[model samples]
Target: MDLTRDQVEAAVRALRPDMFDFAYWVPEMAKEYRVTSVLYSVVSATAIAHDLSPGSELGVPPPGYPSSKVLFRAHDAHALSSLSIFYKRLYHRMTTGLMNCDIISMRTCQEVEGKFCDYIARQYQRKVLLTGPMLPDPEKSRPLEDQWSSWLAGFRQSSVVFCALGSQITLERDQFQELCLGMELTGLPFLLAVKPPKGAKTIQEALPEGFEERVKGRRVVWGEWVQQPLILAHPSVGCFVSHCGFGSMWESLMSDCQIVMLPFLGDQILNTKLMTEELEVSVEVPREETGWFSKESLSAAIISVMDKDSELGSLVKRNHAKLKEILVSPGLLTSYTDKFVEALQNLLNDTNLE
Candidate 1:
């Protein structure tokens, strides 16, 4: 297929921009390449507007939404301000990119984040196009690894807990041991895939005393990557303890597993709230004022969701199942992609006419 420079630029820019220093170049790039559209994660878009817009009234809850439903509370603002210089620069670039783009898009759908999406569109005065979750097609992907398959098969259906904190989150040594011990306290079979904690050579070395012996044969604390989606799809995997990263959020939504969110970053915290509060599809482990979660809290959150008789468990399961059915329904993802393409084509045609 033949494509214009604008089309190629749009496609490349659709992937999230990582060059923090180049955010200032967005306007120049768009003008030079005639770039028709740009996409931003919904959280970053909202945050950019919140931080940059003059007299932005985001702190107040929208009508019909409770005070608890406000997207960014006072504490959230403090947290945002306290981020390291690197993140602060990254956010600044994201803000510039959002401000310069002719078209704004997100890798999410209205069903899950309609209110927030609408708020962003109103704030930016631009149409916010959603590309749905854009998850990978499991059918086309490779099968689960042989080791994981055989081990997961050993457990009863929907009985194993799988915890993966994504690649970026690295806990302190003590916090890492707490997390591992928390899984052990659940007294349920689990697979924990995470980076070795700070100051540890490997996950094995970071474990609590007697941890491996105490939970032998029932737990796997892997320090390397695992096939997360395929593991979540495994029959024996019932609960997913995730960090609520955007990709993991979609994967968790599409799977049948119960979700237990333990978000560590800024956007992750917002995603956790969206899952636990707005959608009511997942439970978040309670954190102290210092933003640390105890092993007991983690275990309790998992137990609450895993217990067959727990009311909270039943409620989230029912809600999650309903949402999953909609998300996985035939052509739902394709429909979003088709509409997004049509919008892009229309924008290009309008530009040509002008």
Candidate 2:
């Protein structure tokens, strides 16, 4: 086939941005992190389409993602995307498989990892690392570490609650009020990091009037930002009240902190459910019939998780310690990252690239 210069230039113009992004950032990030290779998790169609050509291979399609979407949603998901047919066709030609390492233990994830191993890995020949959770190095947060250690010295072990909903999550006034009141009612020393809601003039404006004054130095401390992993690792931190994001969940588990789950999304819901129901390392606060919960219920949940003598509390602490051991054990992260690098190296050495 003859290719015209105009055709070539048009293709170059279209593909230049992706090629530049990959070439520039991937190498920079790899060197900074001291990693041999990086794998990009699929967020958009570019990776799938760039690597796997349409009409190159034909089959029912790959099993894990697009195919699952097709299988589950049937006509609904497909109808919504003009590229649905493209994805259906693309995965059939996905000759190279992928690997996913777990940040939580297989036991903690409750066979969700097992099912992926059985289905996604076995069927697609993908690799998954389910070794253990990886934690951030606390040494990086030196100032925060110093402050935490000094502040926590006055408190006994497992006496303080570390509360942070993370950077992106913001609670409505009702929710925020309830949470604050509940923490106050617990009568335990606590640290809370929060962001003012959007359009709020001040972080002070995010809460109910007189709320801060009532709680000031009573039992709760509020900050705009606190180093999270360091705080969790502090001996004074007995419990973690979190939004149940995967990052927070893993951090809490790795730190052996009892989890108080208040999840708002699907992945979080699943993770929190696993922690509360399956792993017995966390508890969920009860809500009212109208979807708004009382401060009283929240206080009760906190008390249960914090109380060493209570049955459920005892169970949660025990399991949390066990999970924390698994999370912090050495060689899990090294082995997984090594395997990932080796896999990418193998891919690079392959003669299949165009």
Candidate 3:
């Protein structure tokens, strides 16, 4: 259901007491049922920790903890302030969970976020466990939908550009039109799956005037959910323009497509940086000081990675290929799973001794 901010806050408050009760009940149930351990997701862990131990200190970072500037680079004071607030909230939540949990687990690997994981372990004085990327096994998933399969089959290999800005982002009308127009400017077939812009009832309603006629037969701007992983695996899909969500980040890495990013949220921005700056496997569409991106800039970013002769395109493709090989190597994922299970068993033994 669509909810206003006040409504959301009210709903959260209504649920808070029950949530706390559940958190407290968990420990009791564990004792009564002889449940040896409680493996909590980060958010749940935070709540349990708050209710069970309220005054635990979030200690100072260990030496060599990256400075704020290293973690994020804000262009201006306003941006910096926003980043600071967002990170402070995130850090507090994560640290609380890390402190309370018997085993700290993450859906990440040393190949990607090792340094950050190490920092958390040292700062929180806990053993942080990694679960690798935890990507879905594509083999077990259903095939791509017929309509998408047939449509994609019509194009030559690596010829079409595909863009999905995650399920949560809804651009303003003007910005939405700019995005559509930008894709059209790329002069390549594209599939743009996004929510209808703010104040618009449908994807058709939010289109720039005459936009459909101009881009017909070569573009699709759908407003509903589609099979993302299957679509990404299709042969004709060459480049991926994504919002850099965590799941999408791993998906893009695993695929053979060229990567371009446009991130909106705090974690998303960090994911974009990891791909574009640190990993050197993607190019980001730069935003202005106002956090606005123009059609030209958007088109330019896509083209930089899609063009055959573009040095940036070639560079990322090479780097992505190398990283993908490592991520998909035999037993890499299974090794993480195996280790995670072993860690849990060890924790159980330790608990029994105590």
TM-score winner among the candidates?
1
**Clash count list over all predictions:** 0, 0, 0
Ranking by TM-score: 1, 3, 2
lDDT of 1 by residue, 45-164 (tens): 333333444243334333333225426544444335334443545545655666776667788887777766677777667788888888788999999999999999999999999999
lDDT assessment of candidate 3: 0.73
What TM-score do all the candidates reach, one by one?
Answer: 0.86, 0.66, 0.82
Error of 2 at 218 (Å): 4.4
Q: Tell me the TM-score of model 3.
A: 0.82
Which segments of candidate 3 are over 4 A away from where they belong? 1-63, 66-70, 75-94
Alpha-carbon lDDT, every model: 0.77, 0.56, 0.73
lDDT string, candidate 2, 250-291, tens digits: 677778678897655434544555567756788977656555
